[model samples]
Target: MRNKPPYALSSVDHALHLAALLQQEGPMRVTDAAERLGVAVSTAHRLLAMLVYRDFAEQGPDRRYRPGKVLRPAAASAAPVALLRELCLPELRTLMERTQESANLMVPAGAEVRFIATAESPQVLRGGDRVGRSLPAHCVSGGKTILAALPPTELDALYSEDDSVDLPRLRRELALVRERGFAINDQLTETGLTAVGMAIKDAGGSPVAALSLALPTARFDRERLPGWVGALSSAVAKVEAALSAR
Candidate 1:
């Protein structure tokens, strides 16, 4: 039998319990979750909201919470992910310092991308830390950058399985990304947020992750895009070199 820690945090325990419920029991209403967890409805809502934000749970069309992608079984191991974050954080911090914008490191997860680390900008109006967040691959700058680096057959196979994706349109955008050697997401992932991204290649020239600079759309001057791309390229180079050395 597993023993609970003496100093167990009630909030954390509640959230984990909620995640277990969602993963094992499938979708549930807020009221039902509150009853099952023996917490107030408002507390349950807050807990579910946190889960949604972390990609552990998602609210469905019927307003019921269901297990999200993070809860699904995956072949990827956590060790490499942790190492990737460790290797790239310094560069992310440097990029943030140089660009004065939030820098993020992300890796593709099927049709979506997961932000593993972030160096939040010190600016008053800037994108906040988004670690653990997941977004559609075809929508975000980093996602597109990584996708563009994918082999043609792999890219085609990936999008072919998803009916919702417009493969042709995505291919056209990716063509532009390939031509420019960078991708730009202009208020595509979130309103008022824009990001520039470049791929981080491994020793064999395969892209394993992407780096992005996210900022408020209002401050995303096209004239500054070249500078942002240059910063991201520099950060990616450092991260790639570290990965290669490792």
Candidate 2:
């Protein structure tokens, strides 16, 4: 075994030890984590939050940190992201077929949204497939949907972590999203693409993912935008239902 270096970061060491503890001992409380790592409760909370954000660990209903997909035995549990991608693909496919537009599944990754799955429109000229693309959360319709669901404290933390954002403007935008029950991108991320997005909540009603449909800007119409939004809403509900069943 390697010995600890003189300049090693204690925070990193604590996080690594906490990960090992979760794998061996199952779900754990903040107090337990703090005691195990010889750290403060606040530090343990922050470490666990980082793990949760990265899909390394998940917070249970009881506020305990469970052995996340990253620590699960390969033969015992399938990766949660992979399972979500598998379950969401059918819904994305259906959305693409029904709307004849590109559909995508996105999950937040800190300040950005990662596109995990996609179904391209069958049209010759349509949004191309983006199975592994990432974009700023504040700039995309799907990302906005996820951001709109973040609580005030979480939002504040996100803004604090990234100083480039205009907090007041983003607050206004997220408020609009909550009121509208979805988000719309009017060529915000790209010049010729307009997209509508809705959040996919988990059993606990947390916005764990988002669904979006991307259509060409030329084809966009204010009169028909509601219809597209309705389509996305229905698709999101279907995805939520599937997740609930799982």
RMSD, every candidate, angstroms = 2.3, 14.3
Candidate number of the best lDDT: 1
Clash number for each model: 0, 0
lDDT of 1 at 11: 99
Mark the regions of model 2 whose C-alpha exceeds 4 Å error after superposition: 1-79
Model 2 lDDT on a 0 to 1 scale: 0.83
TM-score against native, each model = 0.89, 0.67
Q: Residue 187 deviation, candidate 1, in Å?
A: 2.2
Clashes of 2: 0
- Window of ten residues with lowest summed lDDT in model 2: 70-79
Give lDDT per model, in order.
0.88, 0.83
lDDT (Cα, 0-100) at 108 in candidate 2: 79
**Model 2: how far is 90 from its true place, Å?**
1.1
